[model samples]
Target: MNTRSGLFAVAVGALTALGLACGGAESVDELPPEPPENEVNFPALVQGVVNGWTINTSEEFPPIGCGAGSLINQMRCVGGNCDDVGAYCASAGATFSDTYWTSYFSEEGTNYRTCSAGWWMTGLVCRGAHCDDISIQCTQVTNRGTGSCRWADRQFSEEFPNTYSLPSGWYARGLACTGGLCDNLRVYECQLL
Candidate 1:
């Protein structure tokens, strides 16, 4: 071969020897690629809560007698199906005619209940308050629709973050949730106040 061909052959030989000396490792291009980020598979939430209320009560005054109901509770439910709660409140002298039913949504299910202690405003001392600033966040997989996923008097829930004093109270009227977030909470003060 000519001088150039000889040189080319020597260079090729040197490259092969260098590769062997370097453990013959493949370049980075041969490695597997990295997985993507923020890839959500099932239903989930990055922040905030489901469609519901917080029901805040100050340290001074909190709920005493609490009544819960829904579409399918242990006994009573929504829309005039509160015989259980009604009996409990009546036994405690809390008039059902003057009370208000509070409904809130959650990841588990929708909550339906009556607040009499601080909310009924039945001439009794304000036992507590219902603030809609509940900060509950979560993500899960379910067969629920993308909307509010809320049913009527069919889903019953107890409660959480027990920040109250009494269980039952007198009664009141006209209180509801405006569907707001934690920061933009809705406070239903005692009607007497």
Candidate 2:
């Protein structure tokens, strides 16, 4: 009878231990505080840049066409330079020119080849007030046949060692500087074009 009572006590103790282990002492009041009001919206904070590939595959270089010889044979180039056989040629050329080529290379299957003969405008923002000249470099990998623009970390200037406020109604579009004053400030006043 004493042994039976001991066994019952042990079972109750085990159950109590299990219950305490499962139900921790945490309360609802211990949660983290809410975020501040002035913070930027989550969508805007993680918004993708519009400057990436605006276009992809074109009619001339249909997706999955194989190349022939020096010219873009059968296969349609997708992403790079159109001039380069292995780059993304679809979005590298001008919209009008790409459209023309799309019509010109109108073929059915994986038998015909499209050739890029003229100069395709490399979608590179040139060094100017509207571009960060310091962050200017060309990527070796041609999309179709042209090299893509990349940001090279060649420091152009380090003159003013302080936070300079942008002019009223002007946001930083681009930044370029040489020796002394970091003057070239490309400002965009919410103009979309």
Candidate 3:
């Protein structure tokens, strides 16, 4: 068949499958087959000693994303803080990761004999709205310490308290967002490990 016919066939198949799954009046045979069970216990979620966690964020505009909202979450984290945040958000329990790192930069390294610590991070990440809604929220899902992230848009140029600095002996991490409305991922919580 030509391209149009091929496309039509694919479209019909997808709709048929969707209809069958979504309360559609379809026979049992129309449903997709399930895979055979493979009983295997997955590894437990546990935290361990590491350098620290790092949460990378995106700077998308308009209908911002990343936050655990209506849209698919875009934020992911690494390190101990990642585990804690995941648990906190899921409330299932604390999970752990081993991804710690540090960064040093600039003239400060020469003048003060020290460079900027990678742990120091700041940004007003807004999703739906802008900086006007200066509300930063970090919710704990599980005792194990997993975190769910969120944020908004950017309006004012002034620096809000949208920043975080892990303690001297701590390794914290969190998600980030963009837009200029309400920061999607603001580090509202930090833990010492």
Candidate 4:
């Protein structure tokens, strides 16, 4: 190989070794920008680690709740029928972590559930009736300051650039869906960060 080609190969190898290659690992630029510090809700979700909970895939939702030390962050429907509800648990005071898709093939067929640490389940972006192509939007939370927030019943939608954003004085907490197909994306709201 030419000298220039050899040097290019060495550079590529070095980048791959350091997890900087195209698909090796995400670099800083690939990561979502950090949300404003004062913003109680965030859309910067990453893939979260599984906490080893047996996800229910039945027609009814299993009694899945956040652990004692963890807070309810992301809430959405999962399981084969989408009849089951699940929530992501985050350690208290955690700003935001990552989310992962847990898949299961039950009697109803293939299904998935989204989980994350310290995330505020925003909403889902689906393609059609099957809703298989699910994109979850979430907002993370933390208890850095001394203030309380409440869940509001008001609804909002596709407002922000990528996902939903709340109006002034409102924030997102989690999401809720109804019916077997989860055709609707309901935004859970909160006020006063």
Candidate 5:
């Protein structure tokens, strides 16, 4: 055969030997399938109504995340002899994150921090504090909220202690103190998403 025809014969022979000639290639059905286009990646809810807040008297508890549905949006303090810290949670449907310190002004004032719309009051942290000082520990889902939610008119203290369970959707969200010890507490609830 001519040189060009000889090369073609060798090429065809190699392809035939390797089972890659013409229809010898793999069919569409025989090929591996492609991966999924849109995978579901979402955080799970901590099931049941359970309390996640704790009182750590010695040192600062690291900033914890919402292990479930919403995201911790803000940490705020209401003034007493010491400040009480409250957290605002927002829905995971949107991007939101922030941390700030609010000054303790007076005993008569009950500073409040509220969750935004479509967000739930998940839980809170109550650590020992000096004047205007807050040591936070954002932990678990201590209680489940229900019905229409709103802030309570009074707070927990030495006289009006948190002796009873939170009313309906109400939750203990903040803690005020004296002499670096937790004494007073605050409550509120929001529509959980």
Candidate 6:
């Protein structure tokens, strides 16, 4: 009887050990999965509208009125001022209205121009129409013109106050375009010639 009791005690201890091992394995497997990394959280409306457009650390252009009927027009930053202006008549569906064009910097020597109508905005300089709709190649203009002759993407973000340090994998450079003109990656500083 004593031997039988001893045998029963041994069996009970083995069973308890088995139970504890199985319970530990189950607990480990039941742990929740880790959350995804590098998630971007933004509102639905902003994400939808800004999708595919260039994301830069600069103010968006306001619309402006041009032509006789005050037609709402689109303009691109060409040179000088933090927000310079140039006629942007691309059939590629670019458009701007008066809400897009506004004074960017208050520095006295900065310049801004509109290509659709020749106009320059220099501090204390008489505001007058100095450009025309003729698609003047900024490269040909010897005097520093308000409009940048560079490509759109290059000129829009690089000039003066809009300048920003590029990310690690990105390089700031220039690309030559039609008529031997080069546009800077930051469009605002794009110069003719």
lDDT of 1 by residue, 1-193 (tens): 8886676557545634643111111223122211111211211212111222222222133322333210011111121111011101222222222222122221122211223222221111111122221111111112211211111212221232111122122122111122221111111222121
User: Could you estimate the TM-score for every candidate?
Assistant: 0.16, 0.16, 0.20, 0.29, 0.34, 0.16
Question: What ranges in model 6 sit over 4 Å off?
Answer: 1-88, 94-98, 104-108, 112-126, 129-193
Ranking by TM-score: 5, 4, 3, 6, 1, 2
What lDDT is obtained when candidate 2 is compared to the true structure? 0.21
lDDT of 4 by residue, 107-143 (tens): 1222322223334443333433444233344433454
Write candidate 2's Cα lDDT for 92-168 as tens digits.
22222221111111111211111122222122111222121111111112233322211122322122211233222
Error of 2 at 67 (Å): 39
lDDT of each: 0.21, 0.21, 0.23, 0.35, 0.34, 0.22
Error of 4 at 153 (Å): 2.7
Best by lDDT: 4
* lDDT sort, best first: 4, 5, 3, 6, 1, 2
Q: Write the per-residue lDDT of candidate 5 for residues 158-189, one digit (tens) a residue.
A: 34443323443233333333322444544443
Candidate 2: misplaced stretches above 4 Å? Answer: 1-133, 136-161, 180-193
Give lDDT tens digits, candidate 3, residues 131-154.
222111222222232222112222
Per-residue lDDT of 102 in model 1: 25
| Alpha-carbon shift of residue 149 in model 3 (angstroms) | 19
